[model samples]
Target: MDGLDVLADETALLLASVESLDIEDLAHPSNLPDWTRGHVLAHIAGNAEGLGRRARSMSDAVPRSMYESLESRSGDIAWRSRRTVAQHAQALASTQADFAYDLAGIPADRAGDDMEIRLGLMVRIGDLPLLRLQEICVHHADLGVSTYDWSNWPPALVAWMLPRITASFAAREGFPVGWVEVEGARISVGPDPTTGVSGGATEVVAWLVGRAPGSGLAVTGVDAVPVPPAWL
Candidate 1:
């Protein structure tokens, strides 16, 4: 399926998972450090609202910041998370529906138009669908609520995101120069292959995003797989 279709499917799945949580479940710790499940729920809802606004702005040929500032973003999540689990579920569902509404009228041909997105980054309008999908899939796993893990990811997404994230890491100053072999795809990211990590695409993306312990990958020219420098 295309990225938009994938996002629609994932959003439905995530909402179902959110709906299953009880009030007490929101108080439990999530995989994200120092954040409870409440924080995750709040952030997801806020993200939908912000992204929907951006989509609307794009369609109008106007500019909009996803968040006013970093502090405002955190404050919004904290404030919105004070509600009960059912309230959070309602917020998620409503905001996601708003996002769908904002994007519905965007012509497929116009999706390729370059536009400034979050953090002043320029990307094709088509890329926003994949960005939303990435957020949903990654954060769903980050909720750490059940059997959700890298293995649950769509292999197509793993393939598509692995190179993009690794390239982001490579562009960072002081990031280790290396080659990554993901399910037989050799992705060389720097001047030379000074180090290497080989694994399934799911495992590699998980590692890149700080979701894995690197136990599943084969390493070469290092004692163990080096922790990836943060890219997001």
Candidate 2:
């Protein structure tokens, strides 16, 4: 499937997975620092709303900073998260439904275009919403919700992202770890291959995102250079 199709699948699956959780489950902490499951869930809802607004207003010169104003949005998210999980599920259902349609309505060419739109200070829009899609998938893991991993992430994306992940780490100061290479579905660091942690792609993707790398990567691979976040 193409990027947008993958996007739709990612969105639907995330919504379904989160919806299955108990609302009380939201209060549980996630891998993301200082963020409860509720916070992560709210973040997804908030993200859908934010992206939905942007996708619809692509014509407008809305500064991404508007969406970056997460604090203003968090009050509502936190408040709603207090409701029963079913309630949150409804909210998630509503938002994802709208976002699915909003994302779907985007012209195939425009969505996959090389043009980069600033979604935040650290984010840009390019290449079939790779970053956006990454956020949803990674956060799904962050929320302690299991659906898919880098194994499910597109291979082309993995190859394109591996160099970027390794190189970005090299450019950073105290990020941790080392060089990385994505050979087909596997990732290699220096001479050694991946060990049990999530595959190199997942590990690299998670490592770059400040979360635990999943499987298939050797955590000991660091011989030179700090590990870098897998930035798109």
Candidate 3:
């Protein structure tokens, strides 16, 4: 997939959702508990800005932190969340444009270079676009301003993310060990499974990631559907 192209499309969709909001709408609570729509919009802008900074550093061969500290990141989001709709929209557009440009300019040889995203976590320079795509697509739904939801996620994005998310979730402590059946394809989530969940690919992916409840899914060998812990 042309990750940059896909990222641009997703960014546009997210911006459209943000632009449709009014000042009052921004103050309304989002699907995410305790976060107003303004907070979600601010977070999306902040994420783009952080990722763009990383992309610029990658192109320059000067390593830089994605965020100075977790506290600063939180503060920045809270401050930006109070901006007018126009400012929020502008920040989103500009930061995303910068990220796309910086990502496209990275030296081909550096694509395989590893960069520390957090204290102990590292990611390939080439993978930043896909990571940003995930943030935009998932958070757009979190805004809860429209009919869009997990089912609206691009098929290619869902296919690419489902297994990765499943693996991450399965590794967590207390994660249920069972099979996950999506569209007739059954995959073992953990060893010695005694239970299973079945659903369409999008629903399964959303449920596994804690973005959606187990509405369209079926549980077998268990009294209730297994709910995954919050995804990072």
Tens digits of per-residue lDDT, candidate 3, 10-107, equal: 88888888888899999999888888888898999888878877888877868887888899998988888898889989999998888787787888
lDDT of each structure? 0.79, 0.58, 0.81
Residue lDDT tens for model 2, 1-232: 1456666677778777777787567788877678888877777777777767666554344544336555677686677657667766777678767765655655554543443334423333334355456567767777765655435656555555565565554555544433343344433333234221233555556555556533345544444334344454
Q: Kindly report which residue stretches of model 3 are placed more than 4 angstroms away from their true locations once superposed.
A: none
Clashes per prediction?
A: 0, 12, 0
Off by over 4 Å in 2: 60-68, 104-128, 146-178, 184-199, 213-216, 219-232
Cα-lDDT of candidate 2 = 0.58
Model 1 global lDDT (CA atoms, 0 to 1): 0.79
Give the worst 10-residue stretch by lDDT in candidate 1. Answer: 169-178
- Per-candidate Cα RMSD to the true structure, in Å, reads 1.7, 5.2, 1.8
lDDT of 1 at 125: 78
- Write model 1 residue lDDT over 63-115, tens digit each, in one string: 77888889999999888877787788789788888988887756778877887
Which of 1 and 3 is the better model by TM-score?
1
Candidate No. with top TM-score = 1
Clashes of 1: 0
Q: Give model 3's TM-score versus the native structure.
A: 0.92
TM-score of each: 0.93, 0.68, 0.92
